[model samples]
Target chain A: MDYYDIVMDSCSFPSGFEHALGFKRVFVSGRDFEPANTDKGEDAKGRLAIGHSSKNLLHAARRFAVAVVPMNLGLDRAFIETLRENSTILIIPLSVTYGASSDFALSTNMHLASKMLAYANKRKVRVGFATMARSFEHMESYMQLIELAKLIGASEDEARQGISLAGDLFGK
Target chain B: MKTKFRYVLVRSTTSLGTIDEHEFSKGLMHYIGATNYFKANPRVVKNIDGNSFIMKVSLSGYSALIVALALMKHVSGKECGFFTIYASGTLKALGKHIGTPGTETHSKSSNDVDNFANNNNI
Candidate 1:
């Protein structure tokens, strides 16, 4: 099965990187909001936005075709259900976690990522895992992504599906 | 029962140059800790190319190693990223994907790593 990773814009991937990374497609996000690969046939109605707050996330979901909320804290069942209602997605991004320069930062980031993931799974929220890498150093291969997914408590099958969720967001 | 290891085929953005198994072990230990390191028993089997290599890690350490590989942003001050291409139970099985003419035998470090892991397990 094919897998995808959403990355921030770069000049371009290295030669043969797509094949080397084992991803059928790598969509680039032009900004922190909606990535450039999103279905653009629809105009402003489908703009993608990323929000950090429940209210802001809900607002973005209603204002745009797609709304992304980073999962970094303990979330209540009600808030997640409300996000599901608005069709918002919660994402655990590697960019935020891997930049940790200290052990404490890395541990904290890992705990938050895992907590968010476990909660999202329990809530059956549409959750995603992506590199969201702004640089090649931050980007990971499809298999590595799957491995990380498993590290964070996802089954092998669930991990594969999580990586592809970003592609689904791009409307592929 | 003999201890088995999973061989991981990986590629890097930049040439690894002189970086060896010891360096990989240190980096991984920093992330997963020495305990998980023994569980993983990761050894750099050999460099398939300047940028790609085969790694031998225990199944228990596979996930942690992968995450450590991703978490590692640099080596000796040079920026790089490691991408896992494939993994298999045996070196013979992994060599088929590496496209080498024949299976590469286990390196000395591989044997040492296995003994170390076996000793620790016991």
Candidate 2:
């Protein structure tokens, strides 16, 4: 079965329904942030957006699941407690500052990955870490991936192999 | 005789690479003077390699012509003038690397076009 991973955009979910239904493994990105306004009830527009996105993802993937990665620094314990039983939530610790130096970005991403791994182990949640494209340079991105692997206790070679595998599965 | 509008596809790039699909269609509708615009079934596909994807888009209604013309100006950056109207569609995709391809069409109405263009600074 084909596996598909998508970076969730609040605006693009409606147009993505059909393709989501056909993939075997679906990864919903940016699941860490909850609706800004949660008091409108279950049928609220914000909740509905996420609900619809998640519903389509679940329907599409034969082994459907989600990974919640905190976007802003608002990663609260309460929010983590509300996730569905099967969800894998990753908690990032380092600050993400855009327009920063390459070294700074890599270090921040690595630090966050390590912290997230430790938190996952503590909580007994089977979790994995991912970083955004630090920069457009291939070498820079690859280096960041290496740092992430080291933090995760995977060898550099293992990390490279996994990325290649992911590329084969979902890279264009 | 009914006036026909035309659009010339423009290219855009992002951190990942070039943005293959036209991001907004409503902008085109206002440029051509369309009253109401609507999209047909739209399909987009990105390759597993994270390189590129194919998108098929279509538009209909009397206002569609105006939208098409605005699209051409936005993409090609050329002012509208008396020119032969080409009815061929547009196709574009994004990837790690960039490449150029033929054009595609988006359906949108006049109001939708104005809002989209103004919002995007097109």
Candidate 3:
């Protein structure tokens, strides 16, 4: 019954994250956008990293527990292999939902997410859903977040597990 | 003929005030599209507070409407978050959900629907 959320450190929720939102733990990170190729951070225990390139994606898979797919990802066999090897949790963040400025942007985000999700399904990659909120408006209720995972092509069961699975790796 | 509908409980940011219906429809149209908007045709049934409200929409358009509600990030130029708390088939049930713990308030026009239809309006 205890749900968890992963958000950017910049996100300011109301005083009680648990009482107000129902999330038992909320993981925070300022350097989630750190490139997968860099050694900028010493630890990747529960940190998120951007998989901007195929080369860096394979490398980032090993370095970060969660590789956030911020852009329209074009996955290859080798990338999937590397991600599976590292047991990396591919994250489909809510920033993609809130950041879409227009219908075009929304469709773009959904299309990319659908493709990523399909790959996750075919390859059995552990995926997570997070708010990654940049502002108060960027956050959503747990149900809404799960609905969003469905919006981007996750089934009812897949969406629920994806959200909780991401939390399992980071949340205490 | 009776028309089936769903009541949605929504919670927004504390700063958000009573939402103008037209502006709300316009913001939601961008996400659900004009056709789905007509299918959903959501109307504010009650304002629980500055941060929360109850809405009613046709049952057929429930899914698209929920997605639109979640996608709505700002309203009337103020940054806000709209969270759909609970959705139920009856206003009395929705009322109990928000903990008024009082008399059951059911709009006969919506419940029995009498002669009303989903497409009767312009």
Q: Which candidate has the top score in DockQ?
A: 1
Candidate 3: give the clashing pairs: none
| Candidate 2 TM-score over all chains jointly | 0.28
Q: Candidate 3: where are CA atoms >4 Å away?
A: A17-22, A30-46, A50-54, A64-77, B14-19, B96-122
Question: Which number leads on lDDT?
Answer: 1
The candidates' DockQ values read 0.40, 0.02, 0.31
lDDT of each: 0.68, 0.31, 0.66
Alpha carbon lDDT at B109, candidate 3: 27
Residue runs of model 1 more than 4 Å from their true location after superposition: A31-45, A51-55, A69-79, B18-21, B99-122
Task: Summarize candidate 3's per-residue lDDT along A31-70 as a digit string, tens digits.
Answer: 4333332234334444566534655555666665466444
Interface RMSD of 2: 19.1
Interface RMSD for each predicted structure: 5.0, 19.1, 5.7
Which digits, one per residue and each the tens of the lDDT, describe model 3 over residues B8-116? Answer: 7777774335566667778988777887788788877666556666788999877877788778876777667776767788665654445322112234322322222
lDDT of 2 by residue, A50-84 (tens): 22233332222212223333444232343333333
> Residue B37 of model 3: what lDDT?
82
Span of 10 residues, lowest total lDDT, candidate 3 chain A: A32-41
Residue A94 C-alpha lDDT in model 1 = 62
